[model samples]
Each structure stands twice: as C-alpha cells, then as structure tokens.
Target: MIIVNGDIVAQGSQFGLKDVEVVTATVDLEEVRSYRAAISRGLQAATSDARYQRIQTPFELAPEDDDADIEKRPTLPMQPRMHPVEEEIALSGGCYLWDYLRRSGTAGYLVPLSGGIDSCATAVIVYSMCRIVMDAVEEENQQVIEDVKRLCQYSQGVLPKTPQELCNQIFTTIYMGMKKQSSRDTRQRAKELAEAIGSHHVNLDIDEVYEAQKKLVVNTLNFEPRFEVEGGSNQENLTLQCLQARIRMVTAYEFGQILPTARGRPGGGSLLVLGSANVGESLRGYLTKYDCSSADINPIGSIDKADLKRFIAWAEKEFDLPCLHEFLTAVPTAELEPITENYVQSDEADMGMTYEELTTFGRLRKLNKLGPFAMFQRLVHDWSIDRKHVEGDTAPHYTPAQVAEKVKRFFHFYAINRHKMTTLTPALHCNDYSPDDNRFDLRPFLYPNFWKSWSFKRIDMELKKIEKKRASKGK
Candidate 1:
C-alpha cells in the first residue's frame, strides 16, 4: 500500500493472489519511478516553502555559519539550508533496508567490511537503519515496534533501549585479511567503525586457508601462480587477486550462515550478506565476479561513487560516527595485490579510469542511451578544452583523439565484464540511473567486438572533422 496524493492506495488488488500483488508492488518498483520522483519534488518544495523553517540534515552536513551566497543574493534569500535531494539519497537507502529486513525473516545483516568507503557506507546505512527504528519507536509507532522486537527477539519486558543496543544484537562485520595484501590500517579502521556503530566485529586473516587452497591448486593442476610484483605474468596476477576475492565471498557466507548462533543469539537463523559495491564500480566492472559483489542485497549499489562519498561525509556528522572520517579520506583499493613500498594497488589506477569518469560514462550510457561512438561524439564537445556544452564540467579537458580512446577503453572493459552483472545483488532503486541487470537497466550482456565495427570508424570520422576544422583555421 502506498499514498497517492495523500490518499492510501493498493496496487494490483484485482488479482486474486495477494502475494503477487505485494511482490509486484514492492519488487523493483520500476513502474512507480515517477511517483518516487514526485515525492522528492514535494520535499524539495517543502524546503523552499515560506512556512517551513530550514533544517540541514542522514538526519550529516554541518550548516554554514553564514550563508554567504544567500546573503549575497538580494532575491531568493529563502533558499533552503538543507538539500532535500541529498537527504533523500541517504534516507531512501536506509528506509529500503529497514523495510526489507523487517519483512524478511532474518537474524540480521552480515557485511564484509573491507574498511573502504563503499563498505563503510553500507555499514553506516545499517547504523542509520538502527537510528530509523529507534525514531519510529520513540514516535510510538506500534507496527515498527512489533517488527523490531520480533527481529531482535526481545520478549515480554525486555526491549531495545538504544540504537547501539539494537545494532549490537543484529549487525555483524568481518574483515578477511590476506597474508601479503591486507593492511593493518584497514583492519584498525574497520574495528573502529564497528565499535562506533556498536556492531559485533570479527577480525581474522584468511592466509592459512588461502595457502591451503594454493597448495591444492598447485598440486592438482601442476602449476603455480604469483602476483605481478613477483615477476609473474598478468594472468597470474589477476588469478591471485580473484582467488582472494572469491575466498572472502565464501568465508562471508560461511560466517553469515552461522554467526547468529555463534554469537549466542536466541535463534539459529541465517543473516543476509550485504554487498558494498557502489554504482560507479558496478558500472566500470571494477569488482571481481561473484566476490563480495554477489550477495543477498546491496544498499549503496545504485548510488554513484561521488554521491556516496558526499553521503559519507554527511553521515560522519549525522550519525556521530567520527570514525567515518578515515574512510572518507583513505584511498580506494581492492588490496588484492601484495603490498610493496612503491606498489600498493589503487582502484582507479587499476581501472585505468577515475571514479568520476565512470559516473559520467554510466550516465551517458544508461540515462542518455548513448552508444560508444555517440558517447565520444557527445563527450568530445563537453569534455573538450572549449567546454562547449558543459561550462562547469570538472572533467579533465582532452583532445578529440584522447576522448575517443577513453570512451573505447571504458566500453571495452564494460563489454568484457557485462556478464558479471547477471549475478549482481539486488540493490535499492535509489539512483537516477542504475546498471543493475536483475531489474532496472536491461541491455544485451553479449556484444560484438565494436573495436573494428562501424562505431570506431564513426569515431575516427568525427575526430577528422575536428582536426580538419583546426587545420583550416591554422592555415
């Protein structure tokens, strides 16, 4: 049931199957995109309305002492202090999580916290979930109170007094470290955030299990693998990296299946394994297939990296989890490769594209519905030195040739990694554009090698037009 223009309405009620009606209504929610956007519009209107006082608020973003821009503006002095859009971004993710966990019978959530921004964001959402539940309880929301009590297994007089107490009961975090790759810093960071949110934390290295698997693979296959830093081939390096990721995924599930009982909880139920892959990484296919990306649910998956980072900065203050500050500042890495003084793996460097560019690519591809050649044609104008269309574009200015290459490189990797999305965890429908294959963005996973196709030829043809134009001017 949902409110339409302040009136409660039920969808698909004509069907005899009540279950189908509920499933169709809540599942994916693609049919109601306009409705959700309308609600955001309503909030936007509320912020700017003369009657309501402005309040900056997940519920973070510190307010400016002086609204210098507002003060400067003679008109529109009533500009809202809080951005309703960003507030919806954080709240939409948390609200869906609470809805899912509350209705679905589960012990709690199990997050494979890698101590990176993505995972930290996922953990923070759960913390936000706890806060949402408590807020509901404080408002004397009886339905939410019943769900919370049942999920927490609180009986009779026993009840959750705080978000921390509830979080400790439900949320669990695990950090699987490798002997050669994992960092001490990330481990400490994960522990600190878990403590800040009051989650039950587990820290252990998978090196012993990793070594055993390596030994088995070596003995059975009569071959051995090494990392790139160890003078090994590219294939070996990737294999080793994927091995760690795959191991972590399996370990996460093993723990999720048993953590409830292991923690001496009332029930021996399974926990939902939450994925941390953000929208940008999913678009660029930066994650290992069936690694942590393959999970029961992902809250931050549809949201892009840039906004996710902004949300984290906001959450640091809003949730009062200061430990989130480190996550915001720390460089992003898979930590799959062995760490060396000169050679720790960086996610952007490995992808050969920045997260910012990935966001642009994702928007153009999914939202603009642009093909490779069309993307180059469009971006060359926007990202060119002249910045013809995008006056405020922050992207690096590039020549037509360079822009073409970047577009090709992104599409090439995206094509090769498209199969991975088939198994992408069901992420919340929060972003304007999502590459989620399960429901939202549907495209052919298989594509012909467009490198030698008419697309590339068209790109070359377009580049010549620019070069010829420049050459004529010079002459």
Candidate 2:
C-alpha cells in the first residue's frame, strides 16, 4: 500500500466509498480507481478503522512522487547493511574461499540458478569477478588468452568472434539455462551481458544434472530401512529423498575442480549459495543436513530477501543487463526436485516447514529456554517462523509428552536424510556465526539429551493426569 507523507493514498482500500471525516482532501484518482475495482469484485478489505483513517491535504504544487524512491523505501535497506568492518570481513572471507580453491588447483564456480533474486545477484557477482580475474591474467600472459580462446572453441564447438565473445556465449548460455528461462530473449540477453563484461559462460544443462542426481537420491532412500512403508512417512520420506538428491556435494566438488590449474587460480571462482535468512537458520539444524546451505562459498549469507532484491536492481542498472526485472519477478526455486510442483517457497504441496523454523528451535534449544520437543512444536506452530504454517489458524499447544512423541517422529523422519546438508569443502567463516559454512557441524545428541531429562517425564505424567480428570468429569 502506498502512503504519502502522513496521509493514506493509492492502494489497499477496497471499498469504493471514501469516508470524508478522516480524509480531509479529495480521494486520489488512483485510490478511487483501485477501491472501485475492489468493490466491484466484492472483496473490500480495509486495514484500519476510522480512528487511524488518513487525511490528505491539497498538493497542487507538489512534484510527482519519485518512482525510484517508492521502490527503495521498504525494500533496499535489508541488503548487507554491513559496517565497513563487516564488508571487509565478508570480502576477506570470499577472498579466502577463492584463495583456498586456487591453492587446491580447482576451476569453475558452481551455483544453482533459481529465477529468484538471490541467485541472480550471485550470478552477477560471479560473472563480475570472473571478468576481473581474466583481465588480470590476460595482462600478464598472452598464452593465457590463447588457452582460454582454445578452451572456448572446444567447449562451444564453434568459432567465437573474440576471446571475450567466447566467454560471453558460454556464460550467457549457462546463466539462462540455470535460471530455466531458455527463451530466445533470455539467451540473447545473457549473451549480450556476457559480451559486455568479457566473461566466459558455459551451459551445462543443470536440469539434466538435477534429474540424474534426484533419481540417485530417491533410489538410495527407498533402500533405507527407516524409510520403509509407514502411514505418515510418505511425505516425510519424499522430503528425505529430496535431501539426498539435493546434497550434491560430489557435484560441487567436481565443479570446484573445473578451473584448469594453469588457467585462472581456484577459489578465484566461487560457488555462490544463494540463500536467505530463514534457510540459513534452519540449516543450522540437521534437516536438509547436507544440501542447500552447504556451499564452498556464500556471498549473500548476510543479505536478507528484501535487500537481495534491491542489490539485483542495482546490479541490473549498473551493468545495463537485461532480466533484472524478470529475475526479480521469477519464482524462487532451486529446481532440485523431480516434480514441477516442488519448485518455489509458495509451492504449497512441497510438504513441511522450512529450514528457518527448524533453526529457530535449534537456537532456542542452544539458549536453553526450552527443551527440543517443546521448541520443535513451538517452532512448528509459530506461523511467522515457517511460511507453510503462516496461512493456518492459531497453532495448537502440545504438552511435554505430545512434544516428545512428535520429536521422535520428526527425528526418525529426518535422520536418514541428514545427508542433505552435507557439503564437499568447508565454508570460509568470517566469524563464529555462519551456519552456511561447510565447517559447521550439528549433532542430534540434543534430542536424546532432552528426551532423557526429568522434565520430559514430568510433562508426560501431567498430561496423563489432565486426561484422566477430564475423562472422570463425565461422571
């Protein structure tokens, strides 16, 4: 909803009729039209009552509201509001990852392209850095250029206009393919962007990789004893199946080694894990235990979803790249699932809470405010914590016994799939807080530890007593 200064205007009001007492000025044209449309559709949803109704003033001489300002106001600040120290630390950590890969004699950064803002930003950053590295190499070694030119020819199976042209073609094809927008426009734009930046992009049909990897994981899960036939385990087992396929540490390891030892150095390329605040936190626990967050490097770990979108906008305009809008507007999904429905945060049938909710409970447990069972259910119930639970009515309460049983159920469901969070190389941590780092280790010892505590028994007994009393009251 748009508000001007102190007055409400343009959007949010659903009723066609405007109240005059609260609104001092005439109803704005946009607001009138929007309200009219809403009323016509018979879906008038008012956010506030008369007490908070906004009054508008005459603004005949006012300048038109700034479109850029409107776009930035609520969204831009969330990005890496990094203090100089924080940025220095983040950049230093990125450099460390690059350096480590270089010393290891690896090549190519492998990032999963989601059409969402995070992946787009990551791609832009990787493309930007790859160009810089190539330029520095070209200045010192003429043969370096020749080798890249030849590699480009071999990879492309066609002659490129220039060394940079080959690089652009490769990057563009790969970028578009990864994002799942293999349309002619996206391909042409990616090529254009790559040419402008002088970077080599390779298209490796990530969908094919996702498919092969997904099948392998599913087959492995189907063999697991714990995943055997059960009533409620169907969805749980499917989620675990995803965990195995999603944990492509081996794939990442190979991609990490793709850069030739003689070409540009390792770590010079980075696998930017495009993650968000929620996923980063949930990953702190054992779910998807080996995938998504398990990356050799994470550039946007500190950036929130809203901020990431803003950065993408900045990058699009600064680089004169196409798809800035398209990338931002695209659905958020890693395409790691076999089914089309398994894509995006809002994919309702995806089944289960996100990594963030699990992480929140883990955090609560770490702080010792509540036991794992209690925290787990609370985490499940806290609609704000998990997007899946958000649309439901108020969450129900669970006693210690109920929570204990639920914990056991969840653990049994998740343990076999813990491989989802595993990774190849440990991440470079700027400090102790990073759960995205490959070095971070979490154990399920907490669940058992809490289960054995006296609190668990006491809660179970109390729940039984309450049940008995309620049953007897019928007499």
Candidate 1 to truth, TM:
0.80
Predicted candidate 2 versus true structure: per-residue lDDT over 1-475, tens digit per residue: 3443334443332211112213233234555456666665344335434353568987654246643354433221112223343234323433443344345433334554434455455556555444433554545444434444444433433444443553443333134243332343444544444445555444444456644655775598764322213332666555644544354444444453453332443324433233322223333333244454556456655443444555667657755666566766654444333333332223212424333334433345444456544654454344322234445555444443454455443344334433444442243334333344332556642233434556556555655775586568651
What stretches of model 2 exceed 4 Å from their correct place?
1-94, 101-108, 114-118, 127-199, 204-328, 336-351, 354-424, 436-475
The segments of candidate 1 whose C-alpha lies over 4 angstroms from its true place after superposition are 1-83, 154-157, 386-393, 439-443, 471-475
Model 1 weakest 10-residue run by lDDT: 12-21
Candidate 2, position 208, lDDT: 62
Candidate 1 lDDT, 325-410, residue by residue in tens: 89988999999999998899999999988888888999999899999999998999878875555556577888888899999988
lDDT of 1: 0.80
Per-candidate Cα lDDT values, in order, are 0.80, 0.44
lDDT of 1 at 275: 96
Estimated TM-score for each candidate: 0.80, 0.43
